[model samples]
Target chain A: MAHVSIPSYWKTLPQRYCLIGMKCKNCGTINFPAREICISCKQKSEFEPKKLSGRGKIYSYTVIAAGSAPPEFSEQEKLAGSFPVAIVELEEGLRICAQITDYEEEDLKIEAEVEAVFRKIYEEDKVIRYGLKFRPVKKRKSLP
Target chain B: MTLQKVAIIGVGQTRFGNIIDKKAEELFAEAFLEAVNDVDKGIDISEIQEVYIGNSGVGGGQLGNFSSLMTDYVGLTGASALRIENACASSGFAMRAAILAVSSGVCDVALAGGEEKMNDTPRNRVRYWLGISGDMEWERLSGMTFAGVFALMAIRHMHEYGTKREHLAMVSVKNHKNGASNPKAHLQRETTLERALASPMIAYPLTLFDCCPISDGASAVIVCKADLAKKYTDTPVYVAGHGGSTDRLSVFQRDDVTSINSSVVAAKRAYKMASVKPEDIDVAEVHDCFTIAEIIAYEDLGFCPKGKGGKLLEEGQTEIGGKIPVNPSGGLKSKGHPVGATGTGQIYEIVNQLRGSVEKKNRQVSGAEIGLTHNTGGSGGTTVVHILKR
Candidate 1:
């Protein structure tokens, strides 16, 4: 794998580390991965940098099986037999795709509440890429 | 202003499979020659005014300027030539460009073709190369392969519409059954439902059989002004209407991942221009790059209601003798998707079926006067729909 230059990975650190997205002042739309323009109202409106709650539900999910895994993930796949990736719908009404980590295969399900956590996404060219991955939120038990 | 009408005078394609030894340019020239020969009255190579070649992988294959390379090999170097790259829909857009070139009077005759040699790369390397079309940073960097992207969509479809793995398997069984008679298909052997379902899973819901094979092939078509079409062929397939649309590159950004919006828009435009509704289409060749894609296409193209594509498949309505026979060429499933060549390859099947030239009569849709070809790039980034009629 080729080395991703410092600026390439560094610039997206905000979105990767904090789940920061642009909130449209005019239409109150939350654009994930932070776009300049809002898709909802088509207005060239001012934006507010909003830090997402990092809590969301699994909108969709897929577990990549062995033998057909992508080459880049070969290393990660070796550690975790099959990995699940999901599209998480954030509390702010914006959807973002992220790898579902820190959970077992049985724990993953559609609409399961999940919270973002910092995790190592991949290691390439001696540089370890870190990003947010969603894990199923633990259910609280009531005292009987 | 009204665009002048255009018609497909001739069409040809290489047998869809892994041509390990053949180069891209050679395959292109072979298909070009076949197209030129297929013209009923025969067309002079020099008279072809414009050339559009859809090539996506020739850069990896080492022949970068594939358009000029093919033009030179086919003895049409002087004719204006360019390459179109929209991933899998390259040739579909190339065909659109050629049709526009002829219809707009920019050129009386134009040649549209596509070629790709994907099998030359190692299997592991092929996965890396195929992933380039998607959002590399977010999707690929996160370790999602191409099939994984479709798997995401399939998962949503299943969650939303109750589309089962069995429904997906039925798609493969039907396509493979159709493919068995197609001599040029990559896997010409029919597979049973048991075999399709038992195939190992690549992604949770999509099994090995749900995806198309990486193939190496080429396809070419000769198009001319509709008014002058008769001079070349008595039974020319008219380019009744064509439409193309684009959507957000990343599937997550879209409002609905279950449906490809671009196809819905493109199909509406094509249907409007053709002055026909979806029911009028007697035959179709849809982009079945993945089984789920075919299901979504049925809904997007107005073949069935939204969330009901799975039911449509279960009813066997998409079969050869059913209501609207889709992917009569076995689609990209068994026909083999040679990325660049797939678009024009779809056109080749539609043209042959419309002309009553399909060698295997059983594969041909009887009394088929109208046909449609739906080609998509990436998941839903670009979609081009064409309506053709005899």
Candidate 2:
């Protein structure tokens, strides 16, 4: 498969890096990745651009075990050593899939609280590509 | 206009496995020749009016246009032919097209088939092409492979419905048992649940046994007008009803990952058109690319209520002699899934079961009058359902 060009990669920067989504004015349905039309109600209503809270619970998750990774993810798989990936439900009730990082193995359970953070996805042609990844939210400790 | 009724007169399939000697076209020729020979009264090469070949176009860059190349190789030259690509459900939609083509009075006889040669290519290339089925920019680019996509589904279904890993293993055990009886099956040996659970994990909760093998094979079916079907065979399988539906490409976008909406929509239309309820189906072949997929299919196809698929499998309901036997031809898991060829292969199995031609009596559903097949595209994006009556 051919790699996407710089222009194409830059086009979806809002969705790729920031947690931006489209909320339909007509039905209040949040469309992730910000689509032109609302999926629910089938109305060509005005879509309100909303920056998500980037907070959600893991709806489901999987660990990309070694030897079965795709060619593109070989580097990440090598560096991460079987990292956890998740499909998360945002505070707005919209679902998005992203890799989970900066977490221990025990935190990879279902419904684990996570928050989005921008990180390096990969690099090609001497250009470093970045994208959002979810990390387990830290539990608060009482001050002494 | 209402769809025309179609009947299947002949069906053929090559052994589903890694065949180093054959190419896609040769595999297709093998299945086509056998299908032509299977017709009760014998069908001439000239009788085939149109050909609908389903291929993921996995290697079309190297092999060129598959339909044209395959048709030319099989002496189908000058027959209006085109390739249909809907990821894994390619041939299932091709079956629907052939049914409509005959039902609408366009052609008297048509051939619907599919072929895939995934094994001959390098493993990396095969994986790359398989990833093409998902949203390339979002899913694949983000490091979510096909296995990872389904793993996510399995995780959610388990959480929401209390489905256990043992319930998932039961599907593999049952399918492999059925596939062991099928001589043409790729993996012709039954595996124990203990073995399945202990297999190497490809994706969490989905082990090697849970995934269908990558295979190279072909399948073909000869279908014609329902009324004229008797001219070709004494016991023809009528394609009573057909339906197709589509959903979002990526699984994350869908509200629910536990159930496939396309399968639900397609099954409803097929049931209504066939005038038979889910209980009426005596046998079925469903897309079980992954064990989790088969479990979800049981619910989506209405064999059991939502969230009850795991329990149904636990009760041994999907076994060969159980209520509404599924994937008797070993399914995509034990039988091989050559992507494009899978749907037609399912149709072939149903046609054989309905005609009482399956040599293995143990795997056969006795006195089966109504049968159904459900074929799905990548991650439930597209689904095609067909109902057949003996």
* Each prediction's DockQ against the real complex: 0.70, 0.76
Second chain of candidate 1: TM-score? 0.98
> Candidate 1's residue-wise lDDT over A42-131, tens digit each?
788888988999999999888888777777778888888688888889888888888898887777788899999999988777778999
lDDT minimum window of 10 residues, candidate 2 chain B: B57-66
TM-score of chain A of 2: 0.91
| Pairs with steric clashes in candidate 2 | B4-B103
Leading candidate by DockQ: 2
Count of steric clashes across candidates, in order: 0, 1
Error of 2 at B249 (Å): 0.6
Residue B306 of model 1: what lDDT?
93
* Candidate 1, residue B306: how far the Cα is off, in Å: 0.9
**Which digits, one per residue and each the tens of the lDDT, describe model 2 over residues B269-364?**
999999999999999999999999999999999999999999898777888888889999999999999999999999999999999999799989
lDDT of 1 by residue, B220-255 (tens): 999999999889988899999999999888888889
User: How would you encode candidate 2's per-residue C-alpha lDDT over A68-100 as one tens digit per residue?
Assistant: 777777788787767677888888888888888
